[model samples]
Target: MKTVNLELFNNPNTVNKLSIAIKNESEKLNKPIKIMHICGTHENSIVRYGIRDLLPKSITVIAGPGCPVCVTSSKDIDAVINLSLKKNVKILTFGDMLKVPGTEMSFYKAKSLGADIKMVYSVFDAIELARSASKPCIFFACGFETTAAPTASALRDINIPDNFFIYSAHKYTPNGVYALLKSGKINMDGLILPGHASAISGLKVYERFVEDFNIPCASAGFESVDVLLSVLLIIKQINNKKPKIENGYKRVVNYEGNKNAQKALEDIFYLTNAVWRGLGNIDLTGYELRKEYARFDAKKQFDIVYSDNYIEHQKGCRCNEVILGNINPTQCPLYAKLCTPQNPVGPCMVSDEGTCKNWYDGGIE
Candidate 1:
């Protein structure tokens, strides 16, 4: 591995070089460049620093199905809410999960309505709470591969009491991205792949996109400079008529990724079909608890009945189009009108990582 000049990434000269590269590539292509970034954190960064405004008109960046909270289906949210409302059941989950709206109400609203729901930073925190409480504790597990490894690690080490179980709605990032590409719902020239997810799944996992789809894929870091450099690399690849996987975030990601973490995930969970809020049922995109850990699976341990009533998004919320990159957040009729962050009508407005929320927070149109 060669050392990157860290100063070069931040220097004004490097920014100028990247800008020139983008301008030249746009001129050469003679058409608009569409690059999709598959991470909520990336979307937040782009909006926070006005990266979208700084880019050339030919370059259009769209947010992909990156937000775990945004993608988590309404039915799952309802199930968790139901668990939370049970007098004997105490719901524990990450802070982001608290505000995400279900069909009727959010967990925060449920907590206000006399539910025993507590926000936890980690899965282990839930285990600790379960150890102390005499009541049944259920953790609403949600996230992509980057967060899944840690949850799996906690499950592997922690001794879950009879009253402790996990209601897992966790999904894998690669599978969702692959599903999006295969569905052809959105047209994308290249992918600014997630750095954190690639650090766990490795760069090689995205090789199929380059080989089969002929799409240029680059794993990008979080910084403004790193993202700009990644955009330049993608533009250069498109101009050269070469579509391949590149690692702009080489500092963290490798070809193979974290072996121990991968192994731990494999040991505890298996792939299953998942229902994303916006993307419907994507095959092999979800994680299920291993049979060995069936005792700690909330669905199995609890006598709760799965609701037959289907949970759907609010009427007129174009969150599906927003997630698919077909339209911007402001294009939604309900956006900021009936759907401000304070009074959210859809999942996109509820989650902090959501594109609509990010756009709203930055006052971006």
Candidate 2:
């Protein structure tokens, strides 16, 4: 078989050919195949491009715990909100984080209440701002491996101010996925793994899941053709009864990933148990600033105690079920009714990469 280049799928004729290939494969499969794409960006692409509508009914593509913002605990949001509200402290974070709801308030609401909260495109900007500002600066760091490396890198050579600190809510994607699989929350026949995270963590990390769980896994790129090809590869693996890790996104991702980035992350942060919004506490899935960097750790510097008794979102939110692939975004009664992107009642509606946000923005009514 000829190796398919994702770039070629941009052509109408080539896309038609790929569609036919997928259809033929769909016809050959004995049972409906449920494949989960474990990236929030992938969910955005799927909903925006109407890829789900294009696919065969026999193939079900579900979204997983991909959005870092959607999965961030309410308590962590409350913690950052508290830090921002302090008289002399300034909070910095990526823009999408501002709207995510905590137990009592959001960053936007906190800012309204006279908290010095600011949104930044990158951690570098946050660091530069901290150097210029007179007040204490706290960066609310949140993301998977892809974003964590850069945050880790920023800590390497910089002379951090005495007032500068990091409230890290960064997480590891593979560990979270493994936890979900072990919990049986997701019943996926295979996984269409995240390309960006895989580019940092390497393809080797997923080898254990393939080996232990006997699930076919493929790393996918963000482009439409890349996703289509990844789905085809997954179908081929399932049909052949050979579970393995295949790399569909070869341009950016490799077997070992970016060594320099991995080294930076390992040097600064250590794995620890983390609390996820719907998933509860996942052991060794979270990263914390190393003991050597205690001076820069925000949690240690601030006399704050994050409460675990925060109330969950209102009943019928179905965020937990929607994230686990047990229910679609449309299945929730609050989906477009009470929980549209304009006024999100839940984190799923607020996050740009969230499944509900994707569906709402794409005019999926």
Best by TM-score: 2
Question: Candidate 1 at residue 310, lDDT?
Answer: 50
What stretches of model 1 exceed 4 Å from their correct place?
A: 1-11
lDDT of 2 at 357: 90
What's the lDDT of the predicted structure labeled candidate 1? 0.85
Q: What would the TM-scores of all predictions be? A: 0.95, 0.96
Top model number, lDDT:
2
lDDT of 1 by residue, 1-365 (tens): 77776666566677677777777777888588799998888898788767776678999999988888888988888887886677578999888888877888899999999999999988878888889998888988999988888889888976667788888898998878887888888679989989888899898989998887899988888777788878988988998999888889888888899998899899889999989986789999899999998988887887655575656578899988888888899999999999998888877887777899999999875
Q: For model 1, what is the error of residue 328's alpha carbon versus the real structure, in angstroms, after optimal superposition?
A: 0.3
Q: Summing lDDT over every window of 10 consecutive residues in candidate 2, give the lowest-scoring window.
A: 6-15
**C-alpha lDDT of all candidate models, in order:** 0.85, 0.86
CA shift of 30, model 2, Å: 1.2
